[model samples]
Target chain A: MGSVDRKDILAPQPTAVSESVSPALEIVGLSHSYGSRTALSDVSFTVSPGDFTVLLGLNGAGKSTLYALITRLYAHRSGTIRVFGAAIDRDPATALARMGIVFQQPTLDLDLSVEQNLRYHAALHGLPRAVTEARIVEELARVEMSDRRRDKTRQLSGGQRRRVEIARALMHRPRLLLLDEPTVGLDVAGRQFLLQHVRKLCRDQGLAVLWATHLIDEVGDDARVIVLHKGKILADGSVPEINAAQGTPSIRAAFDRLVQHGEPSQ
Target chain B: MTSETVEIGSVPATGPIRLTAAHYLRCLEGVVRREWLRFLSQRGRFFSALVRPLVWLGIFAAGFRFTLGVSIIPPYETYVPYEVYVVPGLAAMVQMFNAMQSALSMVWDREMGSMRVLLTSPLPRWYLLTAKLLASVVVSVLQVYAFLAIALFWDVEAPWWGYLTVLPALILAGMMLGACGLLLSSTIRQLENFAGVMNFVIFPMFFASSALYPLWRVKESNLWLWYICELNPFTHAVELIRFALYGEVSWSAALVVVGFLIVFMVLAVIGYDPARGLVARRGGSE
Candidate 1:
């Protein structure tokens, strides 16, 4: 992370995201549990096209649980989750087809080269063999990882690997991108680079993003946030709205007040 | 809105949405290719998978030759050495170990591996799981062939044509064992304790079946153990492979193997299903 080259970690290059005509993700009353322990309860939210929505939460705050439900890794029994108007369980093929996800854990096969990993993803999406190579080249170039395409994932540094993962997530041309704690282990520059790249996706390409993170600083001034604490949403609104509700100067202050006092900010 | 994104979010169909056959085919190829590539890179497994069986052939066969006395079994035309009697069992052993290895890897993938990438695919869950099963089966079949070729050098011979004919039997056996592994994997909550459970399952299945000894001999000793051997699916799998390797078909064993494949596969699918599966009951992919 310390030796990360600036050239290798390029700033977000503007690219056209596939346009989304409606809200990308809609969850209503989604709740999940593990035996006696509830992970999420009656969670509801929406991310419109081109919006960078932050799912803010602390550890065990149900952010990952929310992600698991949306991604269909775990079933949500109590609520309806619609992605681009398709319910997750009823029409999973359509619901998941338009979505791209970067899980909190590193999912790349370290033994495979960067290109192989990207190619695997394209194949999973059933992307045409002809366009797969071209798409891989395009996405790799966005992360400044074109030169490292032939290198095995284990050979790359942590930041470089994260860049490749982000590239892989977008290979399907998904309109909705969900990244769960994408900046967990990266350096300051790496984190900033990831933030800028994803934010730019929302700005330049009309891509809807749900960025889940515990880091308060990741919530920017223009960000729409859904603050989740202890399996419940404490605030679901723009940064200013949350701050105003809590009579605070910033979202950080608002979140602190909400978590400490156990009061809803909205 | 771009055509690509809008096309996916179209009004939901009432029934299972159909995708092009080519799409499923390509996904299958990609997954199989990845699984094979990963299996080969871990060189230690070659030693563990092949050598253990070879040791059984080289050592156990020598010691058991006169005492255990393999009489003319249906698969063999005349009296034979323990090595020849054990080849099919060892080949099935390779497949069984391969199956367990698949289960172990799936456990790892569940928590922090490429499984996240896999489950996220728009393809149906059953299709994805079946493709993964096929991948492991392909690897296990190749391992059986490799072991057979080596067995030839050791003078533990089967008819050359048996080499070609045994493939289908090995595949059926592989799937049965693989699905069983998948079912076991779905039940396992964590990775660290899997090997212990695997040893418990594998050793019991191997010893309590016809893999290393004839069920009749066990019948001679204890009728109840023979009944248990007859009931073990691994017995059916190994017997199916044994008869096939001798260019014969054991329809009963084959049917039993197929039956177990279906049962295990259904249980595994149920175990992995997000809506009603064990995964959601336990803590999900953490």
Candidate 2:
């Protein structure tokens, strides 16, 4: 795995509007359920501009459920969801417009060429014809899949398909990117490659990011972490804050203590 | 016991559901383009749709010719051949297959995780479904017209102007079947259960309609059964085409076909609404 520098990964860049105060995404009291099953109950958090926010949880801890609500896959039964100060339900188009999402499953059509898939996404965001021609080329180049653009998705390896999916999601240049376990099916090298590229994009472009996964090792000590368990926000703070609370210096130990015993490390 | 007022997943109370037609159309167009490409890649799909009709017309109709004699119907002026009588029905049959196959694909879409991508769009669910219906209708119409051209070349002919009127008839029939497809797509949760549903829907719709023989031919058996054929929406769709090909109009058939289209479309929209959770797959770990 490639080591990404914290400074380079969290670089603060220019903002046309003042960025001293408001965060990129703000969620408050967002709760939802499936039938009698409470999937997410009163979860709340905030992600600042250029902040690499990683959500840590166990299976059935509501990471995917929260992802569903945030991306508007499954609407929230209650609570406030705001992306760049705009409410998701009030102005869903504008809220969704500001965000790029890579779903847990690969949504690319196996029958269509990689270029065709990118073109389809570009059109969905209402990109101009003149700009689309340039954007498609630039995007594929960024993911290092330019040569394979002409090939159908079924022909590509799993890692290649994942890379193409990332490239396609970035075509709109969204202010925030939501990655729901984007690296699940990738190997060690492939995962590290995607993570490095994503970290660079966030630092260079000042794009806010929410990376949800059940594994604690996926995130670094400096990144903001939220612990979700049994549809509740168990903890929300920087990694050191959680470590301090758990009486341990490492995040993995703190996470293990919180998830296994539901208490701070003694 | 009081009915439980259980509130499941819903939109945050602050934002209203606002989705414009134009934005919805764009997303729908992208999905339809992908689906069309998938359909084109499959070779076996052609055998059931394009070749199946020809087989029935050439072999079945020719064999039945010597056994059963068909009388002239409203659109026919004299003792017309049985093949000609079945052509309009065959055209309607193409539309039926188109609608159900699209529904079957929707079930497959759920299995493959593609449907969730489309549902996640910011547009309202109703508009998303309308776009899907329109795409299926367009594909169905193209296939129907292709069949018409081939039948005409074989001397199963109608008035030259009949082609123009047939356009509206095809659209009406397409919407009727397309709406039904959307309903089934919403109701069906698993892909394995689709084959049984397809057999149930397609056979009843085709055999009950005037597509195979004249409605009068069945009237001789039982007036009640004849009423069922008369009231069948597929029959009206067929009659709509039959009259259109003869350069005539059947106002009653037009009304019935249009009426069902609205009802089926409404059910499709409601069934897919997130609040209801009818089409929502059960939650699971990835």
Candidate 3:
């Protein structure tokens, strides 16, 4: 990680032509259901550039469903998802090209070497060979995994694999990054490292981030938080705003109060 | 803010980005390359695919040669050796097996989350699926040719030019079988269910076709069984290759095989549609 200067690594590349001013991600009237069960209903939110918004929800709180809708893995007929002003339904290619994702489960080909895995992603994005090679080096160096580039993915530790995934996600220089419970099984130190790195990306690169997790401690004091329960949002605002609204001193207390009562803190 | 606006080297600050034909071609090439690399790494798979057909050609064909005589068929000018007659069938069998093997990998990919990564790409889902099918077809073609070469060494030789004619027939047959495999994969929700596919799909398709004996021979023994053999798509595929291997053409067989390929490929595309497929039913969460 120390090998590359932060400024150089964070510099924006021209991957898309965005003349319109729009939120990095905007979801409106997003609803989905499986048979008789509703997973999400009339959910709406906006993540602006440079904002690190945490989607806080426990298991089956519809966090994964929302991610699925945004990513177009499961299409929702009732809602509209826009990335950088492009509607996912009407102009999915453009919207998807401007976004990056780290799914909840590990997606690496364990039999492939680290560099081969990254190269495959680069090719999928249609990056020119010269640019792909340069970005691969730069991103690998940022994750401090340059030395492990030739090693097969199965040879690396779980923390190292996560770092490689993060590096690969940045290959296309996406303006918006969506990570679904990325730190799920990591140890304390690994989780801290990943959180710090992503936070820096939001601050330095002006990249909008939607980090979904159930853990309340991951939310910083200045970060925006959306608390989702059973298929709807209980509250949405900065940490302090949520705290004051619930008459609690911490986000954890507010979360417990809201989820237990199935409403806002009083 | 101005510092943030500094343009990186060479990349334009703003321009409308449109995906071109070259981009689609690159994606196709990448997919094919990945499949090739995986095939190279798994040496056992290559050998196992070859062994199945070779065993039939070596032992089964030899044992049947003395008992079951092959008379003059459309493609054959005179009495042909049973081993020579079964060459095309066995080669097509290699393709059928390889296509299902490719489907098995898709099931595994779905379980491991790699399928999610591929589906999330900005490219159209149909294009991605077609590229995957083509990759599997290429691998099947390679295995078919390898078996042909071994059969040649064992004196089950076709005409010198017949080998050249069989290339396109093999490709078409491979695509048809591979598309069927893709359809099965999209419907199958679990890896454990794949064994059922082998029993219900692979065995029935293979045994019901003319892979083992001539249609006329079956009609002499059982008229109902002969009609089922005549209707099997694998039967047309085998006949297409058989005629090609004899430096001739079977227009009806060619048409049926091509027709089946189109139908199976269409069904595969529909089976993988996000709204109607198993992926949609599961919501892709698990």
Candidate 4:
């Protein structure tokens, strides 16, 4: 079960010329609406391998809608979403196979054990039994959840449940991991732990991560930030770049300036 | 060595992950196993599914035995007992209720966000929906068999070979009814409105069919009602089961059941299609 290496699980190989050149994820002219309500309009961004990108938005700024489009939960009428250069709409299985997502709401079955939840996900992704078992152990261990594999998810703490969900997302060895407001409802310590863990994954495993959140504090100096406001992107760059562009000393101040200005500052 | 040993030597260097036939089979197996596990854990659901049919059989059938007159039917050479005549209908009843219950579980899954986990799978939406539909059918069929066993113990007996013949019929009927439930679940957005939906759907489907009375009996009383019974897919399903349980075959009924199954399943797949589905129209609110 432990024969497979941890780094080889989901890491995009640099040796593949085609894959190495393509961004882990790219969205162009992506727009969506529900009847008259436009959730996202002309949103575009790209995340390279090993990049920890933060999608910062206020409560109704269309972050969730964007995630929905990328995950193929809802089909977008305008624009293309590509994963590892494969267009999601044209080649969904290939695109989706390279991606993993942790939605804002908890998606685990409370009645099932942590291992059971992970096993079902592995099966859905078409992982063989040997590979699934090996990856389950490796991922649970990564989240420091090896001891609670057999326990029902309902028995775990809020933070522990979130960790298990993260572990489950990794079961398929996705090169691009998308998390939507994963820190919501967690304590400060839990939030910090989760943020640090994901950041570590980006640095250690060279995986492209898109973390969407409304909280500005989740942004770090080394992270790239995409600020979304009222169905549009207002800013996209590193924290320092955003701060310099907005003439502010910090990301919070830059965020305030961007929200007040309400214009693209890419 | 610990599980974390980063041995990059044996890992495949580069290639798109390809899915095989075995993977699709495993996915189907996983979906069925999850349903079975959930059903076993929720003992109340199993017992309640049994009780509904048992109550109709034990109390309603006994009370109506003296009042209702069953004449010589095609499956029977002579007049048959009311209990015997109603067993097929009662068995179909179990499936109808179970199908609706499974649909309600889909609604619950959507509300709770597990449906999103399922939809995000790389598999085609139709295959995933079919797997889910089949899972519900398996559970419904189990309950139907349990009900049949109890009925047999209580003297509502069929031919020995009839039991074996009825298996295919039960599966077809279960799939048709379960597909209808899937269609409802996909279209009906709010869980709060589900009870009203269930009442509007279940009672009409059960009462307007040949489940309770023969089509001729319904025609004798009301011509329009008889037309509804004849048109009802549930009626065809019930007749198919009845014929099979009598060591006979109803090709017309079988055809109707198969046709309805295909139609309902196609509509169900369309209803769950991510591009034009209710979930898409609502923009993932549920």
DockQ each: 0.39, 0.21, 0.39, 0.43
- What tens digits encode model 3's per-residue C-alpha lDDT throughout A93-210? 7777778899889999887889888888876766666777898899999888999999999999888999999998888788789999999899999999999999988877777899
Q: Tens digit of lDDT per residue, candidate 4, span A165-264?
A: 9999888888789999999999999899899999888777767899999998998876788999988999888887788899999999999988988954
lDDT of 1 at A40: 85
TM-score of chain A taken by itself, candidate 1: 0.90
> Which of the CAPRI classes, incorrect, acceptable, medium or high, describes model 3?
acceptable
Instruction: Please state the i-RMS of candidate 1.
Output: 3.8
True contacts kept of each: 0.50, 0.24, 0.35, 0.47
Ranking by DockQ: 4, 3, 1, 2
Residue-level lDDT tens digits of model 4 in B169-240 = 999999998888888898888798788876888888889987887778889999998888889999988999
Q: Where does candidate 2 stray beyond 4 Å?
A: A1-22, A263-266, B1-32, B280-286
lDDT per residue as tens, model 2, B1-286: 2243211111221222343444455566765675576667765775477777887788888887777788866878899888888888888888888899999988887777677666655556677788788888888888887788778755798988998989999998899989989898888878888887857878877888788877777898888888988878899999999998889888999999999999999988877766555754455443
Candidate 4 ranges with C-alpha deviation above 4 Å: A1-20, A263-266, B1-17
Best by TM-score: 4
**Docking level of model 1:** acceptable
lDDT: worst 10-residue window of model 3 chain A: A1-10
Candidate 2, residue B284: how far the Cα is off, in Å: 5.2
Residue A85 C-alpha lDDT in model 3: 75
Interface RMSD of 2: 6.8
Pairs with steric clashes in candidate 4:
none
**lDDT (Cα atoms) of all candidates against the true structure:** 0.84, 0.77, 0.83, 0.84
DockQ of 1: 0.39
